[model samples]
Target chain A: MLKTSLSKLTIFILTGFLMVFFIGMSIVFGYTNTSIQLAYEAFTQFNESNEHLIIRTVRLPRALIAAACGASLAITGVLMQTLTKNPLASPGILGINAGAGFAVVLSITIFHISSLQAFAWISFLGAGLAAICVYVISSAGTGGLTPMKITLAGSAISAMFSSLTQGILVTNEAGFEQVLFWLAGSVQGRKLELLAAVSPYLFIGWTAALMIAPRMNVLAMGDDVAVGLGLKLGRIKIFTGIIVILLAGSSVAAAGPIGFIGIIIPHIAKKIIGLDHRWLIPYSALLGASLLLAADIAARYIIMPREVPVGVMTALIGTPFFIYIARKGLSQS
Target chain B: MSKYYSFRILADKISFLIDKKAMIKIGFLALLTLLIFIISAGLGGMPINPLHVLQVFFGGGEDMERLVVMQFRLPRIMVSIFAGMALAVAGGILQGMVRNPLASPDIIGITAGAGAAVVAFLFLFSDHNHSLTVSIKWMPAAAFIGAAIVGFSVYFLSWRNGVTPVRLVLVGIGIAALMQACTTLLMVTGPIYRAAEANIWITGSVSGSSWEKVQILAPWTIILLIIAFLSTRTINVQELGDEVAIGLGSSVERQRFFLLLISTCLVGGAVAFAGGIGFVGLMAPHMARRLVGSSFDALLPTSAFIGAVLVMLADLIGRTAFGPLEVPAGVFTAAIGAPYFIYLLVKTK
Candidate 1:
């Protein structure tokens, strides 16, 4: 058992290192006419030239947004899985993304609210409302807040919100381009002020998640056992719900509804580090950040001057990983 | 022995009594389905009285009125019925095969696949400046191919020793995300007209659905519905668990594969005809199961009926609810079905 654990740890470390290496490589490669020498110089030392503007103003902010969004989503997934005791539970699954998307849609179209700060607040409110709605709906039946119930409720609500978003876009054809861009999710061309607005919430959410990691592990043994050990199930539920809202909401604010990273990364982390949240949370966060950053970099270079959405790149890379983890999980279970 | 013939009659009578409860449930579902259909037809922008609608249906209306009824309302109503039936039947088979309440065409990435393919086609062909008429001909084929790719990928990814429901669901979720990302990417980079067209499709409206769509969709729908009906026996045994199914001499793998194929076809066809219409698949099966128990024979038909009625009602509401400003049936279904679904989820626990 000790030997197996050591091997797993080694694998985890290796994967982490590999991800970082790939991200570095991605940042160096782009569709621009600039030579590799210029790319390196622009990235390493700031200059007032066009190369510096492209690197700092465009690529760097994009990379940061990717990392932040991926990390936030992955952490939210970890919290959700632990809280609901369901592997399928993720921010996207629970309608948090849809809620945020809906709020953004409403703000952009109906109200014409354009400020990033306002967008962030609206997204947060939407996430919170969606979570509460799911909780209330799932809890209404005899099973209380069973994992399956929550999953179903979330799926239903997400589907509904998604359709509503689509409805608004369809009716108001003028906003189609803007809404589509946001919906696809990207970190490109965003101002530093937008990142600053969302950073505090992301930090707070990350802190809260880490603080509750131990409790989550205890809760994993089943609710009755945790309660027997004197843990407050109600308080824990509320706390985790708040963490989900914070992480998912802020991520949406930063980068609109990037998908699959949350669902896939946590599962990958779990396979490497066992079921302990202490290791799982950090590993997943780092892994998610690295994956998103790498994917965003690929998006920039893959099509050259015209970039693909970061969300698409992540999905293309992450789906295969998700399948592997899922197969393994199923076999083990 | 001749005197003992009465005992056989008595035994038959006892068995019939046991079956009566199930028969009654089936009858109630059928009645409710009819009620929903009538109520749905009575609603819409024209606000035709239920009596007038019936009269028009029975060929009692004037020429202009008849034209309006046939051209405007009839196609929408028919599309709703077809789409709803397709979704519900697909969902029922999936839920039974997967033994998970949440397993539906949308959940398994088929709709996403269709959505992605249509969006791509819309963008790729738009630069040609082709007539709107020409584009519609090619869109369904693109959507169908996309759905097939996604369906196969999910199946392949989930396959190991056997296809466990959980693994299938996870892989479906993964592929669905990829498909959604692809749709989003296409929308962002594509031309303005293409993007708008894709958005409308994603919202899942039956608007502008000419007789051509109906013609293309009808045959596939009927064929798949028949196939789903034929597989009911196998599905029933499969749901009992794989070990038991194998012990009972059922080809568990083959049965599941065929069922999944049929479901994907139905879903792909429906999505190609309409867009990513929501809720009918998820809602119909749950409601059907409640009324008809877990028997596949009863559950399949009941689900199809309920699905048809739900979509029809949603479409009617979509057409009439805001007067001239029509809502897509897909939107109303989600807005209405989602909260109720949530309530059901909560209450079931």
Candidate 2:
């Protein structure tokens, strides 16, 4: 019991360290590499100069967007994997990204909606619908919603939405250039207002997720065992699913379908802190935020003066981790 | 659905029988491929009769008709059919060796790996070298090498004690996603000027086929198909699961490695020519299995036929659906194949 407390303390300290590190990083790396003093000054003092303005407006907001979206996606990914009992399950695999992307395209093409708040709602609706479709389809036949079925159904659903998105984008040439970076997913130059708009959903979702993490431990003990342990399986499943969509939907709305973080962060957290959701969930959130902010920093510097998309950097980093987990865990299973 | 056509004598001692039914299925599939070829070839610009398409091939039509049939439609259709057959056969071998219906070249990251290499080739050479024609010449070889590397990585990555189909599949999906990300990175970072072109390539089209590509693709596809068909006996053994295959005294590891080699080659060659068309790999084997049962010998040819038919039909729909604005066959096939796959998923035990 004492050892457990020590481990928890270690995790909290590590997470705190990463949070500070990312905050420092968000201020330092950009067009003009600022002195740490200037970075601090930009935060405290109001300045209209281009460098301070960049630090103040661009870098700060971009960092928060990255952190918020990354944290939301990573948590959703954990819920997805746990709920499905599949190591591979993530927002991308479960059609949330594609669903939200399709909604964005639909809003642009049909509804002609340009606001972030509207996209957030549309994205959530699309995500919820896609999740429902995937669940219903996978749950239809015998041995309801097996990992294999969910995987297949998710693939199909993702394909369906992406195709629809491609169709709309191809025909509606006006939306193409506008959506280019959005589709690729970046935290650069985005308005803090967008992040502000979606923060409530994320906050509620995170709180709900944390509240249920202990119960998720019960649910993770397999269906028969969980039922035997006096857990209501249906309520847990429905609640778990709602939180996943809430988290995933907002992230996609804010960032336009960032990949790999959702899948990768939980694995990193698991490697560090083991599988208890109580610790795993928060550890994953902090780690995911740090990773995304770091990737965004690298994304800015990699091409120098020009930036690669944040999505690209995450994919590059997360894939090896993904491959590693697949090797170690999947092979054993 | 099947007719007997041949007898085979194995080892001159215990006769290993070759069912005639498999050959008949092959023959029917061949007929379907040829018929689809004729019909689809006659489709674009103005819809000509299949007879006229044949006549145009024989130099019996107007010059415009001949050009449309032979130069424009025929080569692209031939590429589509060849690519489809190669992918389907690759999928067949993977499904058989891996003992999972989910196993496909695309799922295993081969196509995406190949795609990433080609995109790199495009971005790198086109920018610094300004020698796209030279790089295009080596694109197929580069894609082949990239796919082989990815295939080996996935195979070895999944190998622990011995590989299980589930593990291999899981690893394949992870690697596939990563490789896809690399392709996206190239498109996003390299230059925005080429974004439109890069977009089309990512979607996996069979457009812009020349007679030269068709010529290279044809022999390569046929050779791979023959090799795949000859492995029918080994595929048959592997299908009964690993324990049974081991019980039957075959070196399951060696056989699986060789099958992976064949699938990598087929996918590498096809994707080199046809970009990144997906779902044909997953859908064809399932369709063939429905028609001809689980036997690889029969399933091979039937799948090849169905794959060729599916892609050709997708191409026709893609080219015609938007008229002046032709969608890639990959898009149409995805639209069709994803639904069928969902249906198959729901149907599976």
lDDT of 1 by residue, B229-343 (tens): 7677778888888889999998888888888899888888888877778878988999888876887777888888888888877877777777888777788778788778766
- Per-residue lDDT of candidate 2, residues B90-182 (tens digit): 998888876767668877788888988888877777745444656466877777788988999998988888777776777777777778678
lDDT per prediction? Answer: 0.78, 0.81
CAPRI quality level assigned to candidate 1 from its DockQ score: medium
Model 1 residue runs over 4 Å out of place are A1-56, A84-88, A132-154, A214-230, A267-280, B1-60, B130-135, B247-249
Fraction of native Cα-Cα interface contacts (under 8 Å, chains A and B) also present in model 2: 0.45
Clashing pairs in 2: B4-B20, B5-B20, B204-B276
Worst 10 residues of 1 chain B by lDDT: B1-10
Best by TM-score: 2
lDDT tens digits by residue: candidate 1, A222-263 = 999999999999999899989889889988888887777887
Q: Model 2: what TM-score for its first chain? A: 0.95
For each candidate, report its DockQ versus the true two-chain complex: 0.58, 0.49
